[model samples]
Target: MIERWSRDQVLALAPDAASQKAAAGVSAPAKWLVTGVTGAVVWGECKGSGAKPYRACVDLSEPAYKCSCPSRKFPCKHALGLLLLWSADGAPPVEEPVDWVGEWLDQRRERAARQEAREKAKAEAEPTEKAEKVTDERRARQRAERVEAGLADLERWLRDQIAHGIADARRTGLRDWDELAKRLIDAQAPGVSSAVAGLSRVLRHEDWPARLLAEYGLIHLLAVGYRRSAELPADLAETIRSRVGFSTPKEAVLARPPVRDHWQVVATRDEERDRLVSRRVWLHGRATGRPALVLSFAPVGQVLDASLVLGTTLDADLAFYPGAAPLRALVAERHAPATPIQAPPHGIRVAEVPGLIADVLARDPWTESWPLILTDVVPARSGDAWHLTDHHPKEENAVPLLPSAAPPWNLAAVSGGHPVTVAAEWTPDGLRLLTTWDEYGRVVTL
Candidate 1:
């Protein structure tokens, strides 16, 4: 039996406003040469100005779209129009799809089957690769020993800095810190190395001494936690291991039980560091009301994964990495293609965000930032700095925006001094806006 999608759901797949408007224009019954629905597939040929009519088809299972149009947008106008027609019960039911639709379906099935076979073969061969597995474990143990020695050396160096006073360390210069970071990298402790490198950025601040000491305390705590990881709780030990540079395998994360939900793709941001581009996608599960972070990486100048689009809701299963605060996850299985999200699954008040971060920090002290959706917050400016203040009369909550971020003139323009829903990243520095929903419910990426 075919499960019909609503017109709103179909239109939600449009890539942009122009595509949505164009799709509506072409959705009339008279505009199509012929339209039919066979099983879960809806297909049609739309009359166009060109000699040949445009062919469009939609696979409801994956909710995939294909159109023989010049438009580069996914779910081109013709495809969206066909879906809109189908949604309105205008496309007549048929026994079979036309030649074009049948051929496309066959090709999709063949590709899916090939992928399945590859994965199956890899899974079957894993048990026979015992020698390789043993070698990997041996190398991991050797690296762990090196990391232990490096941390011990770091602890001694930290003590020496404190003993000699902050002035002496300041005079030693950034080269000394860079050499220590290099040693941590050689020890295969990239996580700690990153933390060490970040300390250099703090040197530019006004109260460098106090800030430096606080950062040093955190690093010292990480070293102590790693040393006493064996005595810690299982989850806490995993957290410590991750903070010390050990990574949980993607396959291992997927092997765990999956959390199925309508995961709303709230925001996506790309960052470049050390010639590598990293993409962070934030998801909010409707049913569970839990936030999940999906990360992808590519070299500079290369395209990152464009699968998760902003404002789309994915019916999928996500498997989380092992940790006390399990925010990072892998998409274990996608039940359907991404669709438009009407609104945020859940949102918290500006006052409640701190408590949430505190809870996460209690579980994973090394957590650098958290993703949050703020409700009824209006963008306001005080002198040169900006903040998101609660619009309600009783609540006196206000959170500062990241000082380094460009002045959100677009956001202020959208809000026009009114309350708006915003999805942002809460870092130790300040809030970094990602996406916002205006009065018309349109998504605006900051």
Candidate 2:
């Protein structure tokens, strides 16, 4: 008989459980219990060292298999082999989940509920507090002082650049921006640094006069904002002043309780303009199932935190940056690393692609190179339409596909009625695909 599923595929679906083990040889068989979609649970145990022994309690209600193993690779090979065996037999074992498994399940539900309640309370309380006038005033004063200092430094630097000649700056290449940006950061003026970095871009582009004017205008604005801070409205004054050169300590910003969630580090990107550098880390919360964006900034030659790896999970407590629209963050207990998470599935209706492609008429439609995994592929042919069917049925939901004029890669047809399109590049870990959508109303990459 043909096997219903492969060993690797079944193992891939298992949740990570490395954090629960004790060091040294296992006196008894290690155990694991997994619940399947149909409310059935599988309990199993593992033994042996070089050649492992695995025993599982199979549940027929929903196909579930459990195994005991010490490998950090989730279900390991034993569980997958068991599931494969069960699938081929076409009959599930009749066994109930043990007390320990039931208890863990119960606790998970309770924790989820508590987290929801806390979030609700926080949301309700956010707008009720007084405007914090004293703190605002102090912050305003500090911002003003920093901006003044930064503008003075920037003015001096600009004069030096002019004296040395614009050609000298051009000869220095991209490194010049990095040096200036770092100086601005050191002078407590991230905003000015950002503005200065813009000049670098303008310098490279055609029609340099307007770009130069705009860059000078921005610098002039920073100078004016610093000079007129006392005369402006409190909020605008604060914004302008801060943008010029002020910085708040990270500790101060992270003082409040941050948003807590099991966050999945989805993607990371880095960019440098002038001397300033920025690292963007995108997170998706598993509990709330919401996406959060976090940013880290560094001056030239400085290194940022390397804790946030792609696909890993982190149970983080994050604080939002203080602003009108602040990003959520991790505050304390940042070390409680979670298991690696898989990207959600992205699929399309059987008939969506043909029309989408024909309408856009691009040889390649994906903009960003996100990996596209199609679970369900079905072939279809209409009077004037032919398309492939695909679906992403993960818990976090599939990323939407985008319509693009041309994508950089090709789409491969999978066994199911689906066509899988992946980015041209491949990493040792796996395929890294951009999750976006196309004009034909599909998520291609983001």
Candidate 3:
């Protein structure tokens, strides 16, 4: 018998508590008809609800899984259960894999070999930079035409909302919006489709009428912006194009001059969807005082790219993506890994709220959210309403907190009745805090 992992280690791979529980339930030897451990690979045949058994295999060396179960969940329950059985105190004996397992392993090896060959060919036959740019631009133009058609359709749909009363949003079915969004997806306009889906979510809210109108306005604004994009400034035009689902080439962005700064990582979040896991890291440039979001993605179980440690600063050069509000960016180069640093005495402070709004809307009206760092602000509660107020109560600075934001409990606790520099997002509704740096230079995510 061989045991490669502790029970806890095996269960840790489960995506959720439910999967962990289910894996434990099916870990008994009676549940598996055949079990074998061969080298770094574990293979098992578990009798499932169906007449035929389901095959499960895990490659311990690379920590990969392949299962015949129909469950879309990566490393499906069967894989987890097989690992649990293998990790049991009296584990399965090391034996040569059965015929079915051998076939699957062979297929995996062949696929990997083909992939290596393809990558090798690509590396050996790399296109010249000029050729690559020309190809990329041509593809971008074709995609832009499709996006334009989709935006036109979305604009017409927004106009239809005005024909009927705002209450008509309730009568509009979820599938109706989803269907149009799917069409936009087919038209390669994911940004507009995402906004359409957001509108659908808004319609379910208690204040659907007002939310619907606002979303309607946003779509109309984007449509109008798209039409007059060519007439706008170069950067603003790029911003509108990006908002309408046009992607800037990473190589092009990297080729541009990089902004060297000591960037402080403010907040970090990881979102897992289907087979992909995306990491969004927000970095605040200490020198330039600009906020940038660096995004990275990996397969479900793979390790992510270099991480951005929260509350730490890194001397790095970041390449900003072309946009009117250039928050999204890529780390082009780094002088050193991030290190802990005292909270610098600088965060962008909007002197005039209306002026900030006018500036952002002027650059890109359809921007749903923008980075906002408020200096010396405190979370406050007043007669069934919550908002952030400037340190001085007598001062004229008070902005309502968005309903969806993390309640101000943590912010209040961290503040302890004092003002703090807060990093938040400005939406159409109000401010939503992301991270806060207190007087003691301590950082907490709200």
> Clash pairs of candidate 3?
none
- List ranges where model 3 is wrong by over 4 Å: 1-142, 164-166, 204-206, 272-275, 348-354
Give the alpha carbon lDDT tens digit for every residue of 1-446 in model 3: 23479988998899989888888887888999888888888988899999999999998887899888898887788899989888874345566788887898899899999999999888776766668899979997988788888888887777776875666466764767888889999889888788887777776578877777888787788778888988888998888778778788899999988999999888776789779999888788887877888899999999997667888999999999987767889989999978986864376444566687788787777866777778877888877678888787567668889876657898998889887888877787787778887667888778
Off by over 4 Å in 2: 1-146, 149-190, 216-242, 270-279, 285-304, 334-337, 342-407, 410-446
Please report, in order, the local distance difference test score of every candidate based on alpha carbons.
0.90, 0.51, 0.81
Report the lDDT tens digits of candidate 1 across residue range 150-170. 999889989988887887556
Give the clashing residue pairs of candidate 1, or none.
none
Model 1 worst lDDT run, 10 consecutive residues = 167-176
- Put down candidate 2 lDDT per residue, 1-446, tens digits, no spaces: 22355534554455644322221122122332232222444444445454644454444344443445555554455555345444444234445555655664577569779999999988886655434666778877886566567677777766676566565445573587788778777767777777666567656566665656556655766566567768866645555544664655678767865778877665576779669888767666667645456777899799977778765688788776543223435445675756755544233343343353343323211111222223343333333333333444332222222222132233322223343432111121223333322223232332
Quote each prediction's TM-score.
0.70, 0.37, 0.65
User: Which one wins by lDDT: 2 or 3?
Assistant: 3
Candidate 2: residue 345 lDDT (0-100): 29
Q: TM-score of the candidate numbered 1?
A: 0.70
Judged by whole-model lDDT over C-alpha atoms, candidate 2 comes out at 0.51
